[model samples]
Target: MIAIDDILEKIVSKEIEKKEALRFFEELPEKEKSYLVSKLKTHLSNNANSVENNFSEKKERTLKAVTELQLNEEHKGFIDQMAQKLEKNAPKSKENASECQTYFVDQRRTGGLKKALKRLQFHLTYSECDGAYLYDIDGNKYIDIASDNGVNLFGHQPDFIKEAISKRLDKGYPLVGYTEELSQATKLFSELTGHERVLFTQSGTEAVMWAVRIARAATQKKKIVIFEGAYHGLSDTVLAAKDQFGNSIAMGLGMIQEFADELIVLDYGNMEDLSIIEDRADEIAGVLVEPVQSRNPNNQPVEFLKEVRKLTLEKNILLIMDEMITGFRVSCSGVQGLWKIKGDLATYGKIPAGGMPSGMIAGLTKYMNYVDGGTFDYDDESMPSVKKALMAGTHTRNPIKLAATLAILTEIKKRSSTSENKTDESNSCFLQELNEKTRLMCEELNSFFKTKNVPLIIEYFSSLFRFKFLDDPNGVVKELVFVLMRINGVETSPSGNCFLTLAHSDKDIKSIIRVVKKSIDTLMKQNFFYISDSIEEDEIKEDIRSTISTIPDMRNDPEQESIKNDQMEKLRKLIISDLNNFQEKEVTI
Candidate 1:
């Protein structure tokens, strides 16, 4: 017999399973069982509060570090230099920069590093995009590794997609109503995803939001289970994270705290988390998964996904595969096809419309019936039967979008037919060739990093790859690397993520590797990897402001010239002192 105190301690420490603890409680006398239940509730409540407090403390520390890094002199100077170079190379982009700065609120372009970039008045205004390249207004070309955030599976403005859009425009480009294009596109998507029903939305976020609603209506359950670090769009219901105690916490402000009440956040790729779903099976409406998280592509939990599929089926809960990033990029059928694990419902965007904005929700008919009222025959006077859920959008099935989608699906079908049995090693088909090229590029880059002993590594899942730091304690080195890459004429996602398109060539791949090598070497020479811990934040900020004011373009203000001169003199003294310190260190060595 286990002592009550022992069981309570193990439960608090998570050493014993909840089920085991319950079994032990069941064996106790009635009075003891009641006492244990009360104690257990209290312990769990205190544990939750402790977890929340820890998260708050860690968040505070991170914000402080970010503030300090932002004020670092070297970081500011590098960004200013990068901005000046970009402005010189792309004069027209500079001329038109205000149009975007004044009207557009693009967080992706200016979020975390906004203050530095904004002060420098930096922006990238594209004039045209062709195969494997983006041309700025001033005619400077950059290899398009960003690929419009993975929407351009075949690169920018592919001829096939362009032709499809042109054909639709010539046909008057109906803004509303169904067409044969919609029917064919739906049929193709249904066949590709192996889902019986298909519904279109204007964006991936809408698709996910509706999928959750449909699941709730169909299952009559309120709770949704999503994994940590998995992005399922910006919907209020799905934008949440698991605190240390497994309680739901909204990821951002403006989200109602109660919106996360029915959400159960779980640890991605953890087998033990499956038991939690089982424990709360009766209340769960669905399990939403992103097979490869766009932010953290290294996590490809195949076996765990298989187990989720099995568990959801056994428990009669819906499984929603959010393939907004992985869909049509990894394979013709997305992760479900690649991993051979099926979800009851799947959401797709990005590549599905071939660069056109569209979203699709495909699922088994039983659950999808909630979206529409199931099939009804007009001649038989049969009315819609099943319960309905609200799902409507102005651009849900735009004719032009459907035409482009049909064209893309047709192309994918042709490529997939030939590549069905081919592995990543085979270059027999276009998709396989692209995948192989990406794999080889990543392998070569990883090998170079290893040989150079650079504290950076690349992780990829198919054509999607991201740069990760091995030791960036302050988390500022990655941002520096991104700026360096841009200065070297390579564009990447703000998070240092890259998506290789089918349009990228062997030469382009080599150029990318060269740019990465150059960027890393520059960072190493500047000693960016070894940030000094002793520098005071106020001193750093003052030094950077002084340096920035000394730049030739910033000399327009005559009144501040005297102050600038004094700051420059101080900066000169500091530089000489640094050199003297370096000399002393060398003599000591």
Candidate 2:
């Protein structure tokens, strides 16, 4: 086997560029390369786990080595190549049924499994993903718009994250209990969320369950107030919804009937509806909200949230913000920092785990103390009986998850601390650019639909967007549109929820607009969307002109910018005034 340390030392001593060293390393036989990587990882881990007295010394040396070995463009390109090679050998899908059948029972709703196969004329059995793309079993490639429900922040197979996790694995995975990684993750969570205390869980649902229990225990109240269409979790208590008359009702078939009595479901975004909380303030434990409602993202009224804060404060009710989907997606501090409304407690998951499965319950010390241990003064007769909140699981403090979380938090803080004058190459600036590109994509989609006199529109909440159809006269046109999107090499959920990640470039966004336009045209040819009047040769050309207008000059070239602007004006005329020219021509799809 090759001496990994010798190679590393040579790279650090500037005898060879990091890129060239990596190239040499990649050219080795697979078994040898894997052996060399494992050895290096083990060497790093042993040094990392040294005695406390020598820890700083070891860390300084390790950091120096890592700085020299840091990945550059060539290294990332090599990693992507390796990822693709691995995907090339992925096992074939089962013959009789889709792979989703083995994992979930309801295949129809789970990312268009059976429907995509039968309707879209193809199936996508993914082998691996890297950054913005998914590679399937048959070697087909597709750009992922869904982002596995928005879990990937920097995208799949990020080199820095992979290295960090590999280093932790070399130290040995602590599946049974806590480790220094767990402590580090806790400290990072506290610093990032501004929460005084924290608890870990295996999934978002567990975090929500813990938050509700903590809220109830801390306030000594039995009933909780929740908003309609707010998905806190699958827990019995949080599964209730507000009916037409604003009464709490269990949403699921087998949900506990009595759970409704423990909840007060109110219409979200309706300030007047919150008045009911005033009457029940004495009995209410807390109010659970999504900050930006998942169902209605376009209407995140700041006034409503401020009123929520004021009402909760005046009535002495706790506020629990569920940032499961909105946590890192919205901002580094989640919605609390974005909207500047701090809550008594917040539940986070999704991107908080760095594409892994982990959840967090964070809150004030007074509230979190109910879950953590402490012996009260039993001798004090005035003390009320404290109902301890149960919030532990076998996977609560798994070291692997903690390491991934630490990596994510470290990157987040590092990116956020960059100077304001830095260019877009910085991660924070790139995130801002990503969000802007997403907003522009949404705007372009809506404009294309309206210009062609289609009934569809796209709406967004931060980087998350969903498609909306004004009228699906064919009863299945919406599903057909989704199927068309899949055939066009983009994956999205059936509910039309799409997400944008930091991995997505301006080129990716442009491709999305072009793919969507192609999908719309395909659906029209298949007689999908009901176009009242169309079918002129000039109309088709006009549609192309409209799409071309949406493509911006992201290359920073002045000539290209001017050309794009002129095209935008032509598109405006074609869609706005010239659209009248097609009103008289009758065309049916």
Off by over 4 Å in 1: 1-81, 114-121, 419-429, 531-589
Residue pairs with backbone atoms closer than 3 Å in model 2 (clashes): none
lDDT (Cα, tens digit) per residue for candidate 1, span 200-319: 999989999999998899889999999876888888989865432355655554766587878988878989889889989999999999988887787788999999999999998999
Q: Judged by TM-score, which candidate is best?
A: 1
Best by lDDT: 1
lDDT of each: 0.71, 0.64
Where does candidate 2 stray beyond 4 Å? 1-96, 99-123, 374-387, 421-430, 473-475, 531-589
Stretch of 10 with least lDDT, candidate 2:
60-69
158 Cα displacement, candidate 2 (Å): 0.7
**Candidate 1 similarity to native, TM-score:** 0.76
lDDT per residue as tens, model 2, 1-589: 2144345434323344544554666565433343343333323232232212222232222111111123346433433443344334333533313556677675334332222124232345677899999987666677888887777878786887888889989998867856887878888889867788888899999898888888888888988888765777678878864422234555545666588768987767777867778877998999999988765566587888889889998987899999887777766667787778999999998787987888898988877778855435767744433456766688888787888888988888787777474432232353566678788899988778655655566768778887754322112345456655655677776545689888887888888899889877765554443322212422443453445435543322355656645644454444333323323332111
User: How many residue pairs clash in each candidate at the backbone level?
Assistant: 0, 0
